[model samples]
Target: MTATAVNTTAVDLEQPLQDVESCLNLLGEALHRRDSAAIELHAASLHLALAQAIEQFTAAARNGTVPASLRTRLMQAGGRVAAQRESLARATAALDRAIDVLMPGEPTGLYGASGKNERKSAFGGSIQA
Candidate 1:
């Protein structure tokens, strides 16, 4: 391949790397702010950007060595993303518990047939023969 072709390939690979870095930065900021909407928005873009970056990086690596600095940044971003995911999962679980407490479902095994202090059905009137 000509020098110009090599230069173009290098530039193409660089674009995706930059995009991935930018997406990671935005995602980190959104997580820090605890802005769910912004996080959702950036998360989608980040997924796509990261995929593209990985694909390009793999291709580039086959032809030449990837820079250590970029690899370091990618690892750091991956760690941050994992932490953020864990935090979100915990928060979601807490919210789910709170909702269940606030609006509980029907009690199970709380009462039995012909048992003293048995709970009555929702319909006020008692069951007739």
Candidate 2:
């Protein structure tokens, strides 16, 4: 009787996943501190780490089923990313609203070139009826 052994070696995703998580944490810290330089650096690092993690994960998936623990960690990292995005969106909207309130704009009503409110028409013609 002949028996065949299967290669149970799995891809090492722990380091790649950890690198991404570390980058995310550093980026968060930079953002919190409002350090423009650190933010830029950490943002670049985070981008690279995320790309590497994706490549590793994709390759692993192609080869075989990725372990559940690694998948859970990846999902957690994705959740953090989503949360950060949503928070930034909310803050941006609030800031935009604040700016709009502070800096008022002139209405687009019918006004003459000399800054006089006058009744105009749809086209260049007058609407004096």
TM-scores of all candidate predictions against the true structure: 0.68, 0.71
lDDT of 1 by residue, 24-97 (tens): 78987987898989999999998999898888878867876666666676677778768867987898999999
CA shift at 58, candidate 1, in angstroms?
A: 1.3
Instruction: Evaluate model 2: give its lDDT.
Output: 0.78
Model 2, 1-129: lDDT tens per residue?
A: 111111231337888999989988987888788787997798789889989998988887786777778889999998988876787678789989999899966656678689877765589676566
RMSD of each: 5.1, 5.4
lDDT, residue 70, model 2: 84
How many clashes in each structure?
Answer: 0, 0
Tell how far residue 67 is off in model 1, in angstroms: 1.3
Candidate 1 residues lying further than 4 Å off, grouped into runs, are 1-14, 110-129
